[model samples]
Each structure stands twice: as C-alpha cells, then as structure tokens.
Target: MSDYLPSIYTKFLAQFPEVAEAQGAVAQAVRERTPFDERTDRLLKLAMAIGAQAQGAVKSNVRKALQAGAGLDEVRAVALGAITTCGFPTAIAALGWIEEVAEAP
Candidate 1:
C-alpha cells in the first residue's frame, strides 16, 4: 500500500481485508491489457462504476486509470460516452467523482 491510499480508503480497509488481494489481481490484469484510452474496455467499466454509484470502485478505478496514464481529457471523453450509454445522471455523477481523483497529485 503506497501513500496513494487515502484516509477514506484506509478506514474502509479495516472491514474488508479481501480488498487488498482483489485489488492486486485487478491491477495486474489491468496492467497486462491495452493502454488507457477513451475507447478502452477499462474506461467503459470505470464509467459503469460511476453509473452504479459505487464509491469504492469508482475511487479505485479512477486511481488505476490515472496510474495507467489516462489524462483528464481522456477521462472526460469517456464520461461523455457514459452519458450516452449509462444515461445522464449516472454519467454526470461519475464524472464528478473521476474529476476529483484525476485532479489529485
């Protein structure tokens, strides 16, 4: 666990020990896949997390997206596609969350 794990995440980890293992597998798989792009599958899934109002997943994916070199513009474009696919409200809310994560250093 790097400094990237925010306090919010640490608080949750007290209850979900499995999160670490699951995250490791997901990270490895994601790293083995195509590079981050608005057209990529991971981008679509990130949008879905937003649509589902999954805060934990959204935070994790957004961090992963950034680590995978997804720029804010690329992410916003993905969110636009999400608006089309997952509907307006879900997409907008997710966009907000993604922006928060992407802006972080």
Candidate 2:
C-alpha cells in the first residue's frame, strides 16, 4: 500500500483485514494491468466517481490526483467534463464534493 493512503482508509482496512487483503490484491492487479500513468489513472477514477455521484470517492480521487501532480484546473476539468454524461446536477454535486477536499485547510 502507498504511504499516501488517507488515515480513514487505513482504519477501515485495519478493521476489516479480509476486505483489506482483497482490496490490495485487486489494486495490485489493476496497477499491473494498466499502462496509464498515476495522474491519468487518478483523473479517470475521479471522473467515474463523479458519474456515480459518490461523494467520498470524488473527494478521495481529487486528493490522489493532486498528489499525482494534477493541477487545480485539471481536477476541475474532470468534474466539468462529467456534466454532459452525468447531467448538470450530478456534475455540480461532484464539484462540491471535489471542493470539500481541494479547499481543505
């Protein structure tokens, strides 16, 4: 696991060791199979999260995207681009989710 994982994720993994191991295995497989760089992967995941209207996932991926060297505009673009497919309201909600983390102190 990467040192960059959020504390909440660590706590959840600690609380559910079986799920943690499975998650680790799946993550490793995805990494091994994908050719995209970390930044692209993060952004792509963020877009998916946006489409799903998953608030926590949107925020989490935004943080990872920034850690992977994505700029604010790049992150914002992902949310904006989702507007077409996810609809205006869902995309707007995702933007709020993104901001919750991006603007954190």
Per-candidate Cα lDDT values, in order, are 0.71, 0.86
- In model 2, where do residues sit more than 4 Å from their true spots? 1-11
Pairs with steric clashes in candidate 2: none
RMSD of each: 4.3, 3.1
Give the worst 10-residue stretch by lDDT in candidate 2.
1-10
TM-score, predicted candidate 1 vs. hidden true structure: 0.64
Best by lDDT: 2
Worst ten in a row by lDDT for model 1? 34-43
Best by TM-score: 2
- Candidate 2 lDDT (Cα, whole model)? 0.86
Model 1: residue 38 alpha-carbon error in angstroms: 13
lDDT of 2 at 37: 96
How well is each residue in 1-105 modelled by candidate 2, as lDDT tens digits? 122556888899889999989988999999889999999999999999998888878888898899899998899999899888889998889888777786676
How many pairs of residues collide in each model? 0, 0
